[model samples]
Target chain A: MRLPSLIREVWANLLKKPATVKYPFEKLPLSKTYRGKHELMRDRCVGCGLCAKICPAFAITMRSVYGKVSPEVDLAKCIFCYQCEDVCPRGAIKRGKEYELASWSRNEMIVR
Target chain B: MEALRKAEENFVVLKAFNDLVLDVVSKDLCTKCGMCVSSCQVHAISMTDEGPKSVGPCRQCEACYYGCPRSPATSEELLKASLSSEKKDDILGSYNKIVSARTVLSEVKSVAQDGGVVTTLLIYALEEGLIDGGIVASKSTIEAWKPVPKVALSINDVLEAAGTKYSNCPSLVALKDALYGYDLSKVCVVGVPCQVTAARNVKVQPKAARKIGDKIAFIIGLFCMESFPHVKLAQFLTSNGIDIAKVSKFDIKEGKFRVYMGDAEVLSVPIRNLKDYANRFCETCRDLTSWYADVSVGAIGSGRDWSTVIVRSDEGAKLFDGAVQNGYLEVKDIESDGIESLRKIAKRKASKN
Candidate 1:
């Protein structure tokens, strides 16, 4: 409540480091258990539909590529719940430490 | 000396207590998906219409964060377009045993709506002290899929959250709520594919672990078809002069709308009216059947009262075994062909990919 004391507190905060981190470069140190952007381990992923199955939002769909593989995620509908990663027994799906997911186009958000 | 010994024991207890508290603070893994908003049995955890605000207690049932798949991770390998066939074959071949409704019924029945499978299982876990609480989906309305995540404890509370909601319910937002609002340390959750995916997404975030990690102990997944949009549904019902609010018991029988008001057939509308209400977010979906649910249940390949279930984890299998042993459910081997039919449908749906 004291003006002088408040001024001292403000001055003390000014001397401290900025709370914001410069993203995409000096990334913030994520905790050991941080769940972030999704990373697909091509080899381990059997495409069993576990991620899609576990997804509560149905944002992930299995798109058949003829005789190839099926499974595609619509980033627009994604809620990033990470149930997919936990259900992936093969460890195919894992969360990464990248949170900058903005994109100018919807197409850019879709991950193969 | 006796007093000193007692003090030492007290110190140990205090240190352990402090450690537990620190661990809770250090493991916050909230993904902000909003599933908690729909899971509350008491109609708690509502969104502020702007961002997320508040409504109720964190029943300490870790349904939201645990069910979330988007913690702080990178891309999911399942999202790739090249891993489908082999994965399907593996699931088929590895299908020696499955998690059945009968197995999960006892503990989940009274607590669950309809079949009481999921809710019962969660309750059993809590009763056995396997978990403190759970995150579950509660129906916000009969016509819409607007589910809110709720923290549940008692069986009655969980059962209140029963019934299928056909709209986009974000259970992950409850993860944030569990972290910032409630002091819950452990929880289990139930969610659909997208909400689960969000859990995975949040796993990789920097502060997610400290804010919402280690708090989730189990994830209960629900089998889902595509959900519908809200506005489109309102229009469809309005066109038919069906008072959306007064309407009770919305069901799809033979792909047709079967409306009932307290056991009385009020009106029946073509499924097409509802089909148009299907969320566009669904068509692009890859898994018509859930392959990732620790235990997934749905009516895709079975009768309405019967749910086709898939148990994918050891914990799920354990719960299934417990459910069966407890006499909450009953099951027998039908035929692998039922599962095969599901695969074919999935294939056909995937073929559009």
Candidate 2:
């Protein structure tokens, strides 16, 4: 709309670094609290299931883990609210900062 | 005392066993304790996911209905007849002594919920020829976790039914089988509080517990707060990651529900969270100790590995004393605090309804 402002914006872009990263070659910077694919510490999971009870997405299914039952998370349905990690008394689940999770199959996304 | 005889001497025949299914079972008053299923002489009733269902044609006999532990008609009679002491104890119905005891045998203690006193006593009874075979609630052969009633003749049979099952078992079905199929004239019956009442009914209310008649020679009752449904308990274990098929024992202690697969602990849950998985019928039950039983053995007020046995009647005392004297069990009197603990527990259970 304005010739001077348009020229100024182009001049600013030429000197500035790109906002996006070359994801495969270079890792992206993630916040400490960033929610990503979950990680389950099986040793810490006492199978109390408070997370399963409170999960709003209904993505978690309690599956038999050895002699006891533990939750199996479907990453496809997880909204990354980190509610599961928050409710876990044992701190068995955590939302990690690693977000480069591109799977070939939906079945691969299910963490048992 | 006069009212006791007058109240119980004339045992009235109810309309039908279906009346119990309608009035008690269908009304959600059924504890699913298996007294009716075990006591039914005819193959008229069977247990289902919805609870006991009337299957075959009715013969108009009220054995199943009358023998139901939760029914008012039988409950009233059982209460009067079972409480034959000079005065009610308010906590324990009728008792001669309260003691903490354990079966001395290693085989019993290995798989026991506590002292294995009940199993030891049953073994003693079988060996002493006091009983031909007894009806006991145990895990089903088909389904590992589901409870089933069986006629136990040998010590091994008794041991098979040893540990406490949180699920309600239809024990009376086996009692009927014991009387009819096995033709056992004298038999001991082990069950929870309500079940022993139903067993006593076979003695007092002849028309109701008519399937077994007066065949029950001795009764061993367990202390119970409540029992659970089979499906609910399985769901609970699955939710907790307990493989029911691998479970070797089930126990409730120190407000924790534990499932054991051999010596290895499978899963454990605090008892408070277990309420949702419980049988609806057990919620209405007020008997913690089988008040009407000959001997009530439970782990409530005892030491870590001992069971508190309440010796109620002369026959109950006889069996318990016989077991101890013959080296089947090691006995020690309960402490005042232990007795007080039992009293408080029983009082709390009675107040639930």
Candidate 3:
């Protein structure tokens, strides 16, 4: 393109709002059924280990806690699959829309 | 594998691979000590995400079954092998001598659990050529508070493996690792009550135990009340927000589970709270002082920094006397009254089960 046309394009663009959202301040709206992280209801969980069995990535391990087997999820391996939520008979774990999950240490991703 | 081939000349094998699966894996009785997996010459066993799995076309090898601490035939065989024809089974099994002993070597004392008797004896055995090496429990790197059976080849290795692991260690499984991996002709091994019983069963049935027959020279058993699996221990720690990696030592004293990080006390909780973390096999177990072991050792009814060592067999007596005579260990007669306290503790564990 010509220099004059480039100058006109830059000038016209200066009048518009910034395209990227300020993620820390202004959050974007998430879909209603968007699957992100798992939220466990400790009271509802019977530690039956069905979620661990259905996990395709083998991301979940059943740990024995207080005489019952409990689910421990590694968020790093989770492909945002909602199969755990679908398979859970007790509804102990459900997919929630909180996609901002990032970590410096992989250990922080484990939800026991 | 060659031994099994030689044994094939004698008799037909029955219920070898299936027995291990049915008796241990299915019942959740198998301790993930990796013994059965290591003992499998044909590579018939593997530890899976679920637990120890015996994948097929099995050679019908009975090593996995015999090496299992929770196997069905072990108890009856342990009775015959450990006890003589006349001596009846008791809560505190056969013993030639009982004493409170400690390592005279300061190096041994520095890292020793209790009196460091197990470490001291192993060091003596290695130096004197009584055994080629020793097998003891070491912590698993993947998870804290979990134990793996390790073959300690030097004094440094034995000292490093000192202290109670507070979890199930299939230490007898490493007997195979010691012979094959390290190429030791004879070795001593340390284990808990259930594992001692497995070792004794091996001593009785040479055909089933295979090359394990003459490989194990001595057995040092710990007085176990109960032990937990790795998951349960991790869970218990998580509930208290206590990090397992930071723990340096663990001891059961005066009805408490004491955890130490260096000199500082990390956590001290009642033994009752840990019952839930305990394995199901421990619930039915009757042995407390390792009735079947050649020598059983514990801190019960002994002074601080002393171990209550019960020499149960002539082999045990030989080791104890030799270690004492060599000035590696100092011994004092365990008080007659102290014997009563030990008996009471043993009976409590039996009744609880």
TM-score of each: 0.54, 0.69, 0.69
Off by over 4 Å in 2: A1-112, B1-14, B37-42, B75-78, B83-87, B261-266
Q: Which portions of model 1 show Cα errors greater than 4 Å?
A: A1-112, B1-74, B78-96, B103-114, B141-146, B200-213, B253-257, B264-275
Summarize candidate 3's per-residue lDDT along B138-170 as a digit string, tens digits: 767787767777888888888878878887766
lDDT of 1: 0.54
Clashing pairs in 2: A68-B241, A69-B240, A69-B241, B34-B170, B34-B171, B37-B173, B38-B172, B38-B173, B39-B172, B39-B173
What fraction of the true interface contacts does model 1 reproduce?
0.00
Interface root mean square deviation per prediction: 11.6, 23.3, 19.2
Number of the candidate with higher DockQ, 1 or 3: 1
Candidate 3: tens digits of C-alpha lDDT, residues A15-71: 877888998999888887889888977655645565777689999998878655579
Clashes of 3: 1
CA lDDT of each prediction against the hidden true structure: 0.54, 0.78, 0.76
In candidate 1 chain A, what residue range of length 10 has the lowest lDDT sum?
A41-50
How high is the lDDT of residue B154 in model 1? 67
